[model samples]
Target: MAVRQRVVAGDEVTHVVLDREWKVIAPIEDYLEYLRQEQYSPHTVRSYAGGLASWWTLLEQRGQDWRHVGVDDLARFARRLRDRGSDPTVLALRPSKPAATSTVGSAVTAVLGFYRYHAIVGGVPAARQFYVHVTGGTMQSRSQYASFLGHIGGGQDRRVIGRRRGPSTPAPLLSPQQIAVIKDDAARFEDGNWLGDLRFRLLWSLLEETGVRIAEALLMRHRDWQPGTGTTAFIEVEPREDLRRRLRVKNQHFRRIYVGDELDDLYGEYLFLLAEHGFQFDDDDPIFINFYRGQIGRPLRAETVYDWIEGFKRRHPLLPAEWTPHWFRHFHATALLLAGIPPHVVQRRLGHQDINTLMRTYAHVTDDAEMRAAADWKMLIQRWGAAA
Candidate 1:
């Protein structure tokens, strides 16, 4: 089996899974269409398509039917994913490292969701084995709160038999010095491409200051930037499309991020440079576009940004090998939290739909601050006792 991208309408793209004869798998396609109808993001649908494709391939290898899969079969599939990898057909010449716990969990979750959807709609039997029902339990006995409509089901509950996930790791942060090094590196004019260098610097500056996702930044237009009266400015992030590429803002919400004079100055400089190169942009034009390579005046792709970071890493061996552009985002949020910004405010800035998500993600930062406060309290008490 294989996954293929299909363009629907004019610019919108979706994914489909194909069998050996290159025919679309009906059940998977139906489920994916249901997701699109429910307004799920295209990126999310693509990921689910890949997971379902892998599951189907595994089923084919074992000569098993989707309607007949049991909990044991799912368990074996999970083991295979953890041991070998996502692609069931490709065997490594040497023992490869297992997939990450989160990857395995996502793959299994996708398969479970596929079966669950089919079970609810088409009365598939396989999904029955994936969930267990509980009818009687006190509110205190329950691990999670029921949904608002959950009481309609006669107080019954269904829970997936899922694998235990590992502990949440703290989000990685870049020090101020490291950020400075990166920005300085990006600002250097290589191959006499001064415009490209300036654009790179501005991109890094925007990400570091706003904490917006790479996609949001890439999809920004000239109209979204609003300069303030003095040493302040604002950048608006909203649901928009890039005509040249399939780019979108993730949350589909309007957000305005506050910025200082430095970034505003950088923006002005970049625009001036663009005009000097005889490239005039309208208000709705993309702010970050390719000037030096690959279809000039088009919005930059996420893959190209990743490639640039990889090349940067290779050139600068002293920098952290694992640092990506997203690290700038983590550093932004962590710095704000450390500086006593409210969690809700940070949540809004980062475009998270829920406050609990922001809290959970940065719980470690708060935990570390509490520990430091306790140490300081102990030191103060000891100092007072000695004086007395």
Candidate 2:
């Protein structure tokens, strides 16, 4: 697949690249259009587009034009990638960056999808039977490795992942004190200091209050938030189907979340601001305006929220501000849960597709739980006896 760079509208370059099967050569713009027409979120569009970009780059390296590549070529390419020490398991995870086994699978999938699309659209002869090869994820790799170990020792595979209190390894989250400090500092910024300061507040609020991915938050439109429905917070956190075929609205579910008190003032102020700007609070207009750049009134992108978080880190000195925007989500979920909210409730609030997500994310916060439990063990035993 030749990644031919052509300017679509003066200096705005569009890359025309081939998919894995070397069948469908498409300009990323076309796919983006397809995604938009399908009502896919911008984040999904960017992610798929990015994965496709990598496939095109791989195809370019192999000197295979997408118009002429076949199943054998993709298989050979896969072998070549594997020989280069690309872990099959890492490829499976499709991690974004930095993680050791991140992103190779997406690259593979991009090419496969490209080929699949081309075959369906009459761009190439039928070859789907051979082109689609699934990659390995961490869990699959672990199980395989464990099985191999058992085979070697002639014993049962006995590894057990128990949910005692926490995961063996957990990502760091911001402490409440640190989060409070971050919030205070963010609030102290005088209005009008930044172009999208108000919008930033909304973004932060959602991350802190709802524990949603910033990408999910960016995908939200005005129509998604409903006015009072008999005092229940009228909000629907719909997954952007186009951002990617897989939508993990916090890996829990695509569902509604009550904004409740935490987001009430912010929502009210935002409503007034949206009205003041002459924009209708309708379903079409994006809830978060992309005002950081010259693209005023345009809907915000996932990257835009990332930029604000980056900026927030630069401005806040009172807190351990190195935490990423994602940490806000970690802070929110654990905080909501620790504050006596049920896991199911938090899952719904965060729009998580599953309860396992909540478990996996906050499983790291067990040190405090253990300490509290230890302190109580002696007290209850002595005061309330065995029942306590």
Candidate 3:
């Protein structure tokens, strides 16, 4: 875990909230501190920390030793994990079992992360060393391993270690009502203690309406959104040329979408406030500005979004549990597809690289549609047989 996030872009990034989301460079303690400094929503931090803690305890139990680990040791560790009745091959949830292979894979990757950090501070080993050797890690798993190591330096050297395979699975979705409740707080925030939070309403709203990622939402710039000529207004988002680049879109493809009246009106009102107070809408200006201290022209950063969401959760102590931005993504896609939107169209809207991703994530939701298609084919076959 790291404390200070790397500066959005800098030579030396002190552990800050931004660093928490951008870089995974800090030690667990610093990462934890950075999480606090960045005001990471308690629940988000808790979820990440809970996973990290499981990793940390496993490390301590294994004797925080990082200097020497080979593939054999890693394989042995995986075997040991399986022997202990941990989830053998599961990716996320396995409350019923000790843990699954996917989680075991995660634990292994976490250990590998520790060593990679050590290598950064201590220098690389003389020979190619294996921090985590997976019996089942194909090229696909290797890519996922790369994702986990994305935050650490020289992590690229670590071969991404998963099997080349199909899409894994979607995380569970928060109920629509639950999302509505969170949105309710956001709606009330038009006049809440946290004035900066008014953005949450728009932010959460956008995530639900479209399957945009948190980083994508935070990167929204004045120039990215285009109000079309007709009654149909669309916002054009292209992938940010650089991930570190602020106010940039996620994917590179030009995705033009119809911005519903609700969002358009809210965006209009926000910009009006900026104009009334003498704010400049420069070409490089970010759309979501931070008004916490009533400072004009201060754009909202990514960490600020997370912090705000967590804080919004604070207003409702009576609520059962807190939520994160990703949940909105799940809710958005699942709700739309279940409502009968075609998977391909949903994939395009969600900006997934493939239609299979949409189907795999919402397998339970899409199952019925597939069933209906199957029935139609079956009836057509029967009719053809009768004609013959």
Candidate 4:
């Protein structure tokens, strides 16, 4: 099955999956339409469509009907998805890299949601078999009385095929030295093109300073920047649309993050370079635009950033091969937490809605900080006893 994008009424886009004969798969299309009606983001609908297409492909290979599948079928499908890149026929002792657990989990979640929707609306009994209801403190119970809402309906039904998520690992960080190297490399004049170099430097600096998401950085407009007195500037990250892509800020919330004088100076230099190149931008114009690539003056796309990261990796083999622009944001958040910034304050700065999310993502950092504090406390006690 193949996924296709279609623009519906009101200029909204949606996705549907097609079979071998190029006919739209009715059930999948129905579920996708439901998602659209529920106002799910286009990206999410597209992802769910892709996941459903994969499931359909698996069913076709087994000659099994979607409505007749059981829990065992889903388990097998999950395993297949997890082991996507590994060739079972290969004889090598070292196994090929498998898909990330989160990727497999997303696909599984899409499939499960599809089945659940069909079970409720289309009366498919197979979907009902995938979930079981639990009460009290059984081994399979997922209830928690920690929160007020959890106490209301904590022992609700649980999916039998769901993957139990483990504690989140510490977010990968870019060391200050590595960030310095990257910014320095980006600032170098490439082919004696100062404009291009300045643009990249500003981009990297903005990300490092504000810790904004790549989408937020790309979607920012000049008007969103408030240049205050010397050494004090702020970027207002608001929900805005891009002319070239359907990118939107996560959580769709407005936040203002402070930037250092260094980044503000970089921005000034970038604007000066832009003026010299006769590319004047209005206040409403995107801050990060394509100055040297396709359709100059158009807002920069996220794909281009990824491409740049790949090229940077090639040029500097010492840098992490898997590094992306997101590492800057992670580095920023970790730095704030380690520097004694409160979790709630960091949450707002990073545009995270929940304080628990900040805590969970950087739990390792907090744990390490606590251990070090304990060591310092012990030393303080020892010194006090010696003085006495």
Tell me, by TM-score, which candidate is best: 1
- Name the lDDT value of residue 268 in candidate 2: 69
Q: How far is 175's C-alpha from truth in model 1 (Å)? A: 1.3
Better of 2 and 4 by TM-score: 4
Q: Score residue 187 of candidate 1 by CA lDDT.
A: 87
lDDT of 4 at 89: 37
Residue-level lDDT of model 1, residues 123-144, one tens digit each, is 8877766765555653223233
Backbone clashes in each candidate structure, one number apiece? 0, 10, 30, 0
Model 2 is weakest, by summed lDDT over 10 consecutive residues, at: 158-167
* Candidate-wise lDDT, in order: 0.80, 0.57, 0.59, 0.79
lDDT pick, better of 1 and 2: 1
TM-score of each: 0.85, 0.58, 0.57, 0.82
lDDT of 3 by residue, 153-182 (tens): 333444434422334565566776776777
TM-score, cand. 2: 0.58
Candidate 1 TM-score over all chains jointly: 0.85
Model 3: runs farther than 4 Å from truth?
1-71, 79-103, 106-170, 188-197, 241-254, 294-296, 318-320, 368-388
- Model 2, residue 223: C-alpha shift (Å): 3.7
Cα lDDT of model 1 overall? Answer: 0.80
**CA deviation > 4 Å runs, candidate 4:** 1-14, 85-97, 134-154, 165-169, 188-196, 229-232, 241-246, 377-388
